[model samples]
Target: MPRVADGSIPGGPRHVALIMDGNGRWAQQRGLPRTMGHREGVRALKRTIQAAPDFGIECLTVFGFSTENWSRPAEEVSDLMGLVRTYVANDLKRLERAGVRLRVLGRRTGLPDDIAAIVERAEQTTAHNDRFLLQVAFNYGGRADIVDAARKHLDRVLAGETGEALTEDILGAGLSTVGAPPVDVIVRTSGEQRLSNFLLWEAAYAELIYQNVLWPDYGPEALADVVTQYRNRDRRFGGVESATARVVG
Candidate 1:
């Protein structure tokens, strides 16, 4: 219930999106296989999920794989696929046990059948849990998501729904994260400053923070540090402070 000096809400972000980058670089720097870095990055994600509730963040959306990642070397792509399989096989139960709702976003048409099945199973297993939300963006791209939403919107218009009117709220509701709040903070590891086609629409007003540490090195302490930065920001939503400025001055 506390208000910031600028009369803005002073609290932790409700939704946090993480761009987990630099896995390959982390492995190369240590003369190890790139897969090893990905393995460690998954561990980092586990630690962050365990620590997210403590930070009061309701939703945690992570960029695991992008649509463009398919262009990587075949061997590396296969390694990534195997890592995802292992993580789901071994960690699905752990996530469900912790009351974390799982949602896998993006296209699945080209994925292997078994892998697709596992994705569905994970979502079904934790569908009822409401304590926390974890969105795994596999094969996801921001432009593609917007295109998909636009197509769905067209269907409604052709059906004579509401005089064919279109609005931001209506279009956003058609995306994968229909019921969720907008992204509040976007954290990119390995010092990446750009969105890289991850959650472009949802991150319209999110506070962007680029960390120098690689994805594998990001842990609970790093998450806490970034969250502290979020809490200190003055979110005015394009409005300037009026009475609060006079009172604080």
Candidate 2:
């Protein structure tokens, strides 16, 4: 692991979101099954969850499986679903030991009953953990999130709840990540430059980082590099840069 002299990320983001990409590509390049790359990605996820707090991040959200991914070949999708089951079965206790809270943010209408039960149990088991919150955006899409929130809000309005405020806070409450903090930095691995429908609302003013390394290969060193790059940026947030802007711990 790369260590900073100060033992923290300078100007580190409070909330970091990762679009973990390139699993299939990584497998293709290595002449292996895509499932193998996904398995490695899971290992990388474990490393990231363990290292995130040390880097000064309070919240971490990963784009684990997108709704669009269901369009892939049936065998691959099944494999991915199996991977999710395996992850929950194997990592629940370890995550609890690390004080990591597991949160899943997505629609679960079509998910298998057993998998949904596993997700619910994992969440319940880690609800009281305070060290870090890890949100997995499984079967998630940014546009879908917005639409769902809007529909929920409309439903409330239709139920004789008149004059209800429709502010950002209200809309945010209706979204999957209802109480989570906004994302401050969004990182996409595999050299991808697009958001690909991840955290559209929360990441409005986030610092974006792109890495050439695939998700399976991303580790603590890569995370440190992203934080270093973030520290070097000028985040004006639509305002004039502060004359005496300084990095935070």
Global CA lDDT of candidate 1, please? 0.86
lDDT of 1 by residue, 1-249 (tens): 344554333466779999999898999999999989998898899899998877777899999899999999898889889988999999999888999999998988889898899899999999999989999999899999998888898987888775657789878988887777678899999987899999989887788989999999988888888877887676665678632344333
Question: Which candidate achieves the best TM-score against the true structure?
Answer: 2
Model 1, position 183: C-alpha lDDT score: 88
Which whole-number lDDT from 0 to 100 does residue 146 have in model 1?
A: 90
Give all candidates' CA lDDT scores.
0.86, 0.87
RMSD list, candidates in order = 3.9, 2.5
TM-score of each: 0.91, 0.93
Error of 2 at 46 (Å): 1.1
TM-score of 2: 0.93
**Local accuracy of candidate 2 as per-residue lDDT tens digits, 103-198:** 999988888898789889999999999888999999899999999998888888889785686788788888898778778889999998999999
After superposing candidate 1 on the true structure, give the runs of residues whose Cα lies further than 4 Å from its correct spot.
Answer: 1-10, 159-162, 242-249
Give the C-alpha lDDT of model 2.
0.87
